[model samples]
Target: MKLLAVDDARARILAEIAALPAETVPLARSIGRVLAEDVAAVRDQPPFAASAMDGWAVRSADCPGSLKIVGESAAGHGFEGRVGAGEAVRIFTGAAVPAGCDAIVIQEDATREGETVLVPAIAAGRSVRPAAGDFKAGAVLLTRGTRIDPWRLSLAASAGRAEVSVGGRARVALLSTGEEIVQAPATPGPFQIYDSGSPALAEMVESWGGTAVRARPVRDELDAVIAALRDADAELIVTVGGASVGDHDLVRAAAVVLGLSLRVESVNVRPGKPTFFGVLGDGRRLLGLPGNPASAFVCAEMFLKPILSAYQGAPTAPATMPARLAEALPANGSREHWMRAKLTYADGGVSVRPYRDQDSSLISVFAASDALMRRMPGAQAAEAGTVVEVLPLSRA
Candidate 1:
């Protein structure tokens, strides 16, 4: 297989993958989800003209001068009396802007004297008086395809939407394939390794807003692999390890047997060149990530994240930022390098320094990385102070 550029590979992968359809979720359970339908205001916000302050709600025409204080309107309680010419009604914040009232004279701007208060030009030269539909009774507040964060949920709740229709969570089936792979926290024999990639990848799926339905290890036998994949019953199947040339690499053979059309076989990217993507005959998507933990993680971040985003109708883009190289970098024209690095702010912009060692098999390097410093194929050794594309792993 010929090695493809990173952008070209990514573009092709995204094009082949399909987004998951939308589904309705209760408002209480909608947070951290994505909206599939546009959310408009069901009713007027505040449901009535409301006071902006705790001061008296009086005719703006009479706010500049003192008038008799008739009754107090606190929040839920509204004044029944009409404010005749030269009269004012005291009102609190959020109280309905009463009839015949145009402005609120703040208590700080007025001096109280028994039943009457002295006030000065609170409404002069200002249209401070709020009108009906100040926030619009039925405005289209939130558009469709919105990611439902805490703030978005609050907005929907405030807009009187008790339930929201959101994009269905992507169902994921995670398989760890290898005869030598054992479930983690186990007393593994010297020949066996704990299955760290499955759990790690599962957490990654959950973090990307998908529900991980299966995280079990599958033996190297092709039948066992097929059975595991069949039992998963997920919209997307993520297989870790056993994707390479070894005899135990049954994921590729199984995918081919399952009638998955290969999308991209190889890419010119370090640590993840052998990553594979395909779609099953039944339309379920498949990703063949490298078995090495670091390689698997990098491939997951590069391919799986965008797939999940597209499934949820969320936008996905590589997080690129300008950063100066903190140290000299070696040139590798054979493959595009994805160097694990730490990014720090220096002199006015960010500076990225690659980790001392970046072997695909070393998970510790990946765990310590705060960013991925990308050097394109055929590029020269990056000199200190050279600007390059840095994908931030940690926002801070």
Candidate 2:
């Protein structure tokens, strides 16, 4: 297959994507979750006309003159008596609007003398009558697919929601295959290597609230690989490494042998061009991530992370920010590049310094970096001051 540009490949992959339906969750646990249903206010935000300042509430007409104080109203308390002409009700912040009150005169603008309070004309001039529906009642307050950030949580609490519906977590199976691979703590001779990608990938999935059960590692044998792929109960299977054209590369061949329809053979991107994606004969998803540590992670973010988010009804894409280059980036003319980098803010924008070692196989850069800077293939060089897009590393 011919190489596909990053945008084309992304569009193709995303075309196959759909967010899962929402599920009900307790409000307490719903923070950081996505809303599966549109959230409407059960009632007005304040529910009643309440004071916004720590001042006296009085009938606006009675202000600018001394009025006999009928009673005092504080938050949670209501003044029962109606304020007649030349009469006032002393009220505190958040106090219910008294029966005949139209506005509030702050305490600073009032002089207290016994039961009568004198409110300055200037204070009366600035008083405001909070209108009904200052915040609408029974209106859509949050949209479906909205992620429950702190503000959303507060809004839900204000809207009197004890529980809400959200998208369910995604389920995935993580598999890594190679004959030379051994579990960590196994002393490796020069030829034998540790299988660290599966564990790391599993952790990444779990951080996103997705369950990533580790499939048993199989030797390079095709039968074992196919068997392992079939054993996973997850909605998607993530296979690490063995995606290239080397004679040992069995993932692509096994996928074909299993009758999985290939969606994409490769994407025009550096560190992860040999990526593969398909659907198995049984309709299970198959994703082949490049073996390089960086490439594997980039593929996971580009493909797997979005899938997980959609499953959970994540409201938006992963956070991205404008970052300046700390060092000159050589122009990429062949494939879009995802450079692992550390970010800092100096002037008004972020500055990204690429990791010294950009080798796809190195794991230390993944650990040390906080962000990824994207450079499209055939794009011009990024000067030290050019603003570029940065995808923050997942904290999960």
Candidate 3:
């Protein structure tokens, strides 16, 4: 079978997916959720001309002169009467500016003697915040596809939105396979090791805004793999191990038995060439990842992250940036290479240093990497300080 380029494979996988349905969630709990609809302001921000500071509201023309102190205006309570000539109104921050008042004299700038106050000359509208200054009624402050953060939530709250419509979280089932693997906290046989990749992948799924359902480790038997796949109730199923064509690889064969239609047969990338994606008969998507810890991680960053983003109506491409290489590198082979690397920021620029050991099973090396340096297929040798594209690991 002809190997698909990494970009081609990603494109094919994304073509079959769409954003999940929208659901309403409280504004307080909408953080990290993608907006399903535009959020409009219910009313003008401030609602009225307000005082920006705790000061005296006065007419600019009456400043630098002693004036009669009028009624006070506190937050949620406004002075019913307007300020007339030779008069000032005591106000607090966020309070409505009294009618006929165009300037404010801070307490420090004036002296109060019972009902009479001495104020200094001040510019008009110096401390008065105009109504609708921040946003107007019916204005769209937050748009669809926006990811809500604390700052965005505050904006929505200011817009009088107690709840917001956001995309439903995508449920992903993580199935780890291999007869040579065992769950942690259980003593492993001499030939077996504790399963480490699924735990990290589950966290990565959550970080990428998906709900991960981790299944117990399945043996390398075809019936067990088939049973696990059939029982996974999720929109997307991620299988670790059993992706290669070796005799022990049973995921593809089991998927085939379950009516899988391949969308991506394989990718032309180092450490993840066996990665594949397909759609099952029941409409769930399946992504097959190599068992090696580094390989699964690299493939997850390249493919799984984007899939989750697409499911949430967010941008589907990895955000890659250019950085200078801290060490020289030999020419790349036919397949694209994504090398684990460390990044440093200095002199107003980013520098990346690829680890010397590029072995796919080295979990320690991958744990120490903060970025992935991309080397195109058939790329020529590069010297130190050469500019290269890098994808930052968010967890790092």
Candidate 4:
């Protein structure tokens, strides 16, 4: 295939991705997972009319006068008798108000005189919480595609849900193939270098809530590379390096030999032009990233993360904001430029400045950056203070 534009490639990948099936998980283990089904409240919150504080439950008309005290009502124990005329029931916070009582007189305003309690200025509905005030039974508490967080989890528990149906996590396999690539734990020879992109991709997979099933490092051999590609456990296979058209780039050659057709051969994006996307016969996804450290980072943020999120039924997209340019930028060339930059909090909004060393292999510069200023293809130059769209790398 010819080179694909960034948006076109992304749209194709999203259109082809298959969302995973759902599974039941206990509420305790559901945080950060996406809901596959709508969750309904099992029962009403504050199941009955209850008192909001330590006070007396009495008829709304019995305020500013003395009333005979009846049985007491504490949390988990409610008074059974009705609050008749000139009568009050001693109640504590969370205690259900007795029948015929529409209000609670705070204890601070009431003085006890043996069996009679003296009440002062009390308004109707004061210090009283009605049943279902927060949420009613059978109400939808959580909708499908909602990502569960601490606050949402608390709300689910309050809605009386012990278990929920959530989308299954995608199992991803990380593969790194090259003649000079050596495992990080082993010392590299003078001509060899440690394979850093594979491990970083594995961590990124885990951060996006996908399980990294395998991280295999292979030399530039067709058969061995084909064998590693057949790992059956992974729903998505991500290969770092061995994708460019150079003679030593053997991943695409082996994939073609194994009958995995390439869906996207290249993309018009900086630090990621050599990326390749394909699919295996068994319906698993195949994404080949450039071997350069920064290139791999950019492609993962642009492609891999979105595919994984689609599998999880995530409801939201990455955050973007308008940021002022701290310095002038030259007009972009044919490819989209994702300039790695630092964010400066300004009085009006954030400002961004690209790092000087933007080489695809510069890990130090990538580490120093917090955001990616997105410059479109062939865009015109802009002076400092120009507002541009920025995607924060931290959120990615």
**Which prediction has the highest lDDT against the true structure?**
3
- lDDT of candidates 1 onward, in order: 0.79, 0.78, 0.92, 0.86
Number of colliding residue pairs in each model: 1, 1, 0, 0
lDDT (Cα, tens digit) per residue for candidate 4, span 67-142: 9998899999999888899999999999998998999988998899999999986788999999999999999989
Worst lDDT 10-window in candidate 2: 122-131
Give the distance in Å from residue 190's predicted Cα in candidate 3 to where it truly belongs.
3.8
Regions more than 4 Å wrong, model 3: 346-348, 364-368
lDDT of 3: 0.92
**Tens-digit per-residue lDDT, 115-199, candidate 2:** 8899855444234435344457778889987778778888888888999998886679887888878777778778978887888
How high is each candidate's TM-score?
0.81, 0.79, 0.89, 0.81
RMSD vs true structure, all candidates: 3.7, 4.0, 2.6, 3.7
Ten consecutive residues with minimal summed lDDT in candidate 3?
309-318
Top candidate when judged by TM-score against the true structure: 3
Better of 1 and 3 by TM-score: 3
lDDT sort, best first: 3, 4, 1, 2
Q: Higher-TM-score candidate among 3 and 4?
A: 3
Model 3, span 265-320: residue lDDT tens: 99999989999999999999999999998999999999998898889887577789
Better of 1 and 4 by lDDT: 4
